[model samples]
Target: MDIGSEYLKIVIKRFKEAKVTAEKAIEQLTESELFWAPNEESNSVAIIVKHMSGNMVSRWTDFLITDGEKPFRNRDDEFMGDIQTKEQMMELWEIGWNTFLNGLKSIEEEQLLKTITIRNEPHSVMQAIERQMYHYSYHIGQIIYVAKFLKSSDWKTLTIPRKK
Candidate 1:
């Protein structure tokens, strides 16, 4: 059985689907909406994007050679929602995802069993990818929920339309 190729195919497909889902939510939001949080402690869409993008860059850059958590990443600052414009947010989003996907593409079949670290905890390469996929999807769900709330009546359907 070709476990490695099969795993890569599934991971890539899931990642692509996740990106499309997030983009659908993003399409309904304005710049201000991206930064809107429910309250002082909650995260905004912009903040979620920032955090995920930061994670992507850190985890994927030289993925096999380094810890998934990069030393330069300021995990706290990502929640600050410092991005002032949708353009900047999207650009950063693309930058991080591009880095992640490119890194994923670089992985070989043999690399899946190799050990990696996140915050000094050991994980197989596949385990690390699965971890990020779940983490990013969790944040993307938050982004979609917030965008849907912000759009209110104008919210276009990202999934199946409501029952007639």
Candidate 2:
């Protein structure tokens, strides 16, 4: 199996789909609903959005040169859930995703073979993309879970219908 640029594009496609899913899940929520969490240890939908945005920004921006963890990323604050409006969350989410996609779009095929330092160890672009795919998928699952938890009885499926 020869993996190449199309593989990267596939990852991007998944991210796009994941983004849409996250958005739809949040669309089901109200401002008060975003604050809903079943337990003291669980995260609210707002907190999930914050954490996902924070993670996206940290891992995607300066992807080629810097460690995945950015100095500007506030990992702790992401769990605090102080943001009151969905608009604010969406803006941050869009910014983070745009930055990530822009960075990914900028990479050339040759650069994909070059090693980039993620934490302290070196990872090829393929490895880095793989790492991020799992990471984002993990958080996206969290967002979906929180949304479902908040929606409870009235939850609706967000997946688009197949054309006959």
Candidate 3:
């Protein structure tokens, strides 16, 4: 395959891995634990998931033709910790990932060099993909950290154990 095709495949794989890692961490938490924040200033796992899902939906829907920051997206509201149940949180997560993954899969090799706008700022398709990948990775790390803290002694290793 050409480099562009290879790159797309690799990005998809990495995104999937990130999603699974976050979900594994999330699975270890109770519903109440998902909404636990260390302090008033910090966000709960639920808030992070809400923000990530909102971001994904806004950035991925009509990704090429429209600006990534959709007019309807209320980024501020995503941090409000509105997700009340595990089912609701998972639903939002599925919607966001489905929109993003489907959009990513639809890109053609030639489109990689094309410019797109996010909040009216120009970015090459490659740059946009890289940008979201980093953003999601950062949030997923937060989710994992919070899960580890909440689970304490019960936390299962998502990867190889520290000593192993």
In model 3, where is the ten-residue run with the lowest total lDDT? 78-87
Model 3 segments more than 4 A misplaced:
none
Candidate 1: misplaced stretches above 4 Å?
none
Winning model by lDDT: 3
Question: For candidate 2, lDDT tens digit of each residue in 1-164?
Answer: 43667777787888899889888888888878877888889888778778877887888788888888888887999999688787887787888888888878888877888888766788998798888789888888888888877777888877654462
Model 1: ten consecutive residues of lowest lDDT? 29-38
Q: Across residues 1-164, which tens digit of lDDT does each residue of candidate 3 receive? A: 69999999999999999999999999999999999999999999999999999999999999899999999999999989777899999999999999999999999999998999999999999999999999999999999999999999999999999989
Q: In the order shown, what is each candidate's alpha-carbon RMSD?
A: 1.2, 2.8, 0.6
Best by the TM-score measure: 3
Taken over the whole model, the C-alpha lDDT of each candidate is 0.90, 0.82, 0.96
Clashes by residue pair, model 2:
none
Q: Which stretches of candidate 2 lie over 4 Å from their true place?
A: 1-3, 160-164
Q: What C-alpha lDDT, on a 0 to 100 scale, does residue 153 get in candidate 3?
A: 96
Which lDDT tens digits does candidate 1 get at residues 1-164? 79898899889988989999999999888877888887999998888889999999999998888888899999998888679899999998999899999988888989898998888899999998999889988998998899889989999988888994
**Prediction 3 TM-score vs. true:** 0.98
